[model samples]
Target chain A: MFTNPQYGIFVLISATLLTSVVALLVAVPLGLMAAIFLSEYASRQVRGWLKPILEILAGVPTVVFGYFALLAVTPILRLFVPGLQTFNGLSAGLILGFAILPTIASLSEDAIYAVPQSLRQGAYALGATKRETITNVVLRAGLSGIVASIILGVARAVGETMIVTLAAGQNPTLTLDPRVPIATMTAFMVQVSGGDVAVGTIKYKSLFAVGMTLFLITLVLNIFSFWFVRRFQEKYE
Target chain B: MQTNSPAVGTGTAFYVDNTDYYYGSFQAVRDVTLDIPERKITAFIGPSGCGKSTVLRCFNRLNDLIPSAHIKGRITYRGVDIYDKGVDPIDLRRNIGMVFQKPNPFPKSIYENIAFGARINGYKGDMDELVERSLRAAAIWDEVKDKLKESGLSISGGQQQRLCIARAIAIEPQVLLMDEPCSALDPISTRSVEELMQELKERYTIIIVTHNMQQATRVSDMTAFFNAEPTEKGGKQGYLVEYAPTQTIFNSPQMEATQDYVSGRFG
Candidate 1:
């Protein structure tokens, strides 16, 4: 199936990587900011209410987010972009970011909160404002955790099938423009699995190959995430 | 008016008057009044849970960080009410720095740890010179001169505490509030830091909280003893028992609790 594909499996892999990168480009900053808010700026009452809402967002079915993107997000994008497609990677990537927001925000917030209160007091004692303390001391101390959270979010974005399959279209065209439809790795796998193709054929075996590639990518990401968390867990004692 | 405390000299660095602290609904300390003389080391000696640390924290507004904790009354630094409406706590803390009971250097390089405060304060001076001067003052420069770029946590317990001190001093604070600075160190490290405190007192007003009475007598020019009373609601409230010159508190009779504590009778 690798040889039989229109542009081979590279197109699918690249599409998956591009979509996930775009998703993470949006998710990381928003997630990190939300985390900083929860850990530093938010009062206890606000955090108590805000954290569970993010957790609930994480728990929402990806298919539901995909539906929201299709019926709610794409039309809005079309109004601005003039000729945007009904099913485009832009909407898919955007929705996937929100889908993964809770994963990124909750973990990052926990890490930042775990930064020893002493480091914060030390910074504040030196006349640093809340902003300065969070940026220089809390965020710097929680860097490993924040980076690990983003990478894990990236991995989640890559493996996410229903959202991209339903919202990002099913054509495996290799292009950088997010305005057009593109088939990601997971979307292609879903397309094949939802087919009437017979077992023991190259199409079925090619699914395994794609699955293996996705596994390897996520495995590498998880390994790096693990190393970062273990190696740079900041100790302020 | 003739209480053992001398009249508020021009040397007074902090005047904590009738201050009571609370954590949510529970009162921690009551009616704490004292004058911290400039360029002198004042020690707070007390039993556990006596809120000595709480009172010490008030000098720099560190207790303000705790959401539920509140202070009622006045803490003036150099004749200005620091707790007044226009005063910013951040600005107040700049002139009044703190060192925690345990060593807490930033997880940065030793050089960076010392430079952090000065940099954040927008000091445009030669950073290397300032780092060296601060470390020298803390008495850890010679030990850490070779590994200035190493992480501050890589050092020994005593050295880390000194790094914290150097970090505090790099900001050039007028007062240094050390809450049990040597409680986490070995005897050797403790002695080194105690001596450093003596040298530091010549430049900065030093207020220290110590569980060790000997450490207080050895380093402090003035002493304040605190004690806690058990409340009926299964809580404890702390109060200041006596404040005087270190020699007078140790030798003279004023409060029975002070007499018992220094004489090895009771806490």
Candidate 2:
């Protein structure tokens, strides 16, 4: 039932920081590309097929994604990296990335579609190709929404538990290597919840402290996303 | 063929030879033929859905964009067939700009909106000068110069229409086609746009479609009247009724429909 208060607090803070950064770094680019594919490249028929498939990926239990990360993804990484750890942050981050793809894609698509059709026609009438029109007009016009989607994806990644618990290891080492099995805040919460700490002790209080840190991190991301979207939504009429 | 008029005042800019337009088996315009003089304002006046806009769209082949629409017959630009197989619609549209009835400006800065055509054509010259010159020509420069970086939608309806005019003129087209350009403007804005059209005809060949007979009489030197012939299926089919000098058409129109319309008897 004993817990070192200083080490517990430090572990909680570092894990929260690492998880937030890893989530954000993976989500932004994947989300932007998803938005583009869904809004611009996909035909109506393709969209009808692809959108539901993407949402299903989001709806799938995170534990299943974690299981796939452990059995399928980590093994594949080992073949390439040779010394890759069984439960590493990279696999957990990748699964987390996939889990949040629909969030980013759907929100960003809504933003892009919200841009007035007149602006798009105006661009095309000026002889802009589809690529130029999407990049210069559609994407730029919808950039705020895309940014908001990425932040929401980060929030989803930060709050994730079962996937990180299964894929990311329990060692709270503050290392940046993707090949090493690194612990995240959500993983620690799940690890400690499994009878390793008694119900009414400082060790249990540590869980809420970590939960508070996770909540604060996601809250900041959500606020920053709101600010970013508000700042850019001023362009379109 | 007849005694050639002074070269300064007589050259064909647009020549329509037996042109026909159809919307998927529904004929919108019949075998119509006419000549529009260079640096002249030619107005097409007609009742609602009388193929005036269809003919105007034919100048730039905007009709081709509609999947169900088809065109047969030759439209010539100074002697070259505009509908030739090798003609790129984009290039043709660049040379033949168009403004719609409703104001349609890019949701960008006034400067970028004017510079859009120039940029698309890869004009890397001093964009500031080109933007200013085009806006000045469209008669919107004095009003929008201070707010060059502001969004185009922020402008009033009149200014937005003029901004569209400036956007069209920025490409430095040989001709400007207006499909009811003043239909959405106020009286004062309409007057300003009409005056701008008059000044522009000295440089750009202008074709305008209007339902307003007075607009046709006021701004155009040449007027083409179109009438909707009643069909069996409870709809009207459009055909060209007459084409002549505006004064001649208003004073002594040969077609009964033209006289009826000008006299405000019926559209």
Candidate 3:
């Protein structure tokens, strides 16, 4: 399988997408809620303390996060689930979500904060409650920025190598079940690069093929983000 | 300063008495007392930093949005103290709406901009009919009727201001507080808005704060002249100099300050 370039490429691609989906599930809600709280509800003193702490999460080394996922998160999950593997997609993807959480939260907070104060005032003068104002006015105005942050998070999750390689293992399997071990495109690239493969061989060349595929995916995401922002951005004077 | 005037006449919508507004102990306005008559245009004219806008905001408790802003004395709407503990500012704002100096339409379709307020206030009637009625009332229906689905921000500045006014009135508030609503508009737009105010006064009590004294004389039935004096702390403290019928305010003001202000002597 190490020499056969096409043996498990389908499984690797599927694992990459599945894990990214799981990561988005963990990141989007928590990150968006944190952003809204920071931008809207939190006092200046609390925000001063909290925003930096959340950003510090983004600065932690990914290798350390990988080990933490493998050693700590997987062990905890094993206790809850009936059959959880030591090297599984769930724990790896969950940790990946945390890895990208700050990316979404910080960017989304800036977007929500940038919405003009007059819009909120307009909503309030119309008898809208704070919740209604936030959902209808603030969120809608910040939609383009929020969507951009989520796309960046998805890109981060898709391209992340160390965490998946270390925790989700190097076993490529064509399955969506996260309780078992899986391999992502990035993990395969890492494996091929780290092992003793000849420069001219198919296995070594497969790395570039996978790298190109990853690049294309992110390029598509970026183009979509550009289009989406142009389509939905609320211009304020 | 004469706080009350005989020329102000009958039906009172807002009774503001000895109201002192403070932003964290720095007095912004003091001893502002006036009766805003029902279904009439009452304009507040003052120089910059005289707190005409501040007094206007207090009508709907819009100042409550500022963390450090607090008021002393009473502001009553239709006989109820708006600042009372049981009175919800949300409900109070519903009964009394506002239009800002700058036109701020929601970055939504023009239709949604009007519908949003009505929807949030639990308007259970035919939304389309309500939208049309509000737009027609604001006198922007003919210009924007065909492009209802277009972004509210895509319209002209004057049209956007009218849309905002339509948005405010969609929920059917009894009083509309306008803070320099025409300051950001062109002369034509200002004239149209002034005309709209004349029409709107038949149904809703209207209070407008304007730097343009001519506007006050032109649109208001009653006028309040506010003056600012330098305090010991070097900050300006605004107080009402006089309240009278627009005719008296412009032609026969009693106070020298009001006379000088109306005659373009000084702010």
DockQ, per-model, please?
0.79, 0.33, 0.87
> What is candidate 2's lDDT per residue for B150-179, written digit by digit as tens?
988789989999999899888888889998
Candidate 2 vs. truth: CA RMSD? 4.2
Q: Whose DockQ is higher: candidate 1's or candidate 3's?
A: 3
Per-residue CA lDDT of candidate 3, range B143-239, in tens?
Answer: 9999999999999999999999999999998889999999999999999999999999888999999999889989999999999999998899999
| Residue B24 in candidate 1, Cα distance off native in Å | 2.9
lDDT score, residue B105, model 3? 97
Lowest lDDT 10-residue stretch of candidate 2 chain B? B1-10
Write the residue-wise lDDT of candidate 1 on A1-237 in tens digits: 344454678878877877797798889999999999988889989999999998999999898999999999999988898668988889999999999888999999988999998889989999999888988888988899898989889999999999999998988887877888889999999898888767898788878998999999999999998998888876653
- Model 3 chain B: weakest 10-residue lDDT segment is B1-10
- The best candidate in terms of TM-score: 3
Give residue A197's lDDT in candidate 1 (0 to 100). 66
Q: Model 3, A1-237: lDDT tens per residue?
A: 654545757889899988899899999999999999999999999999999999999999999999999999999999998789999999999999999999999999999999999999999999989999999999999999999999999999999999999999989888999988898999988987897989889887888889999999999999999999999997787
Backbone clash pairs for candidate 3 read none
Candidate 1 off by > 4 Å: A1-6, B1-10
- In terms of lDDT, the poorest run of 10 residues in model 1 chain A is A1-10
Q: Interface Cα RMSD for all candidates?
A: 1.0, 2.6, 0.7
Off by over 4 Å in 2: A1-5, A8-43, A196-200, A234-237, B1-10, B23-28, B63-65, B228-237
lDDT of 1 by residue, B1-267 (tens): 011324333368888999999999899999899988988999999888999999988888888899898888898888788878878888888888899998888888999998889998899999999999999999988999999999888999999999999999998888899999999999999999999998998788899999999999999999999999998898889999999999999999499999999998877
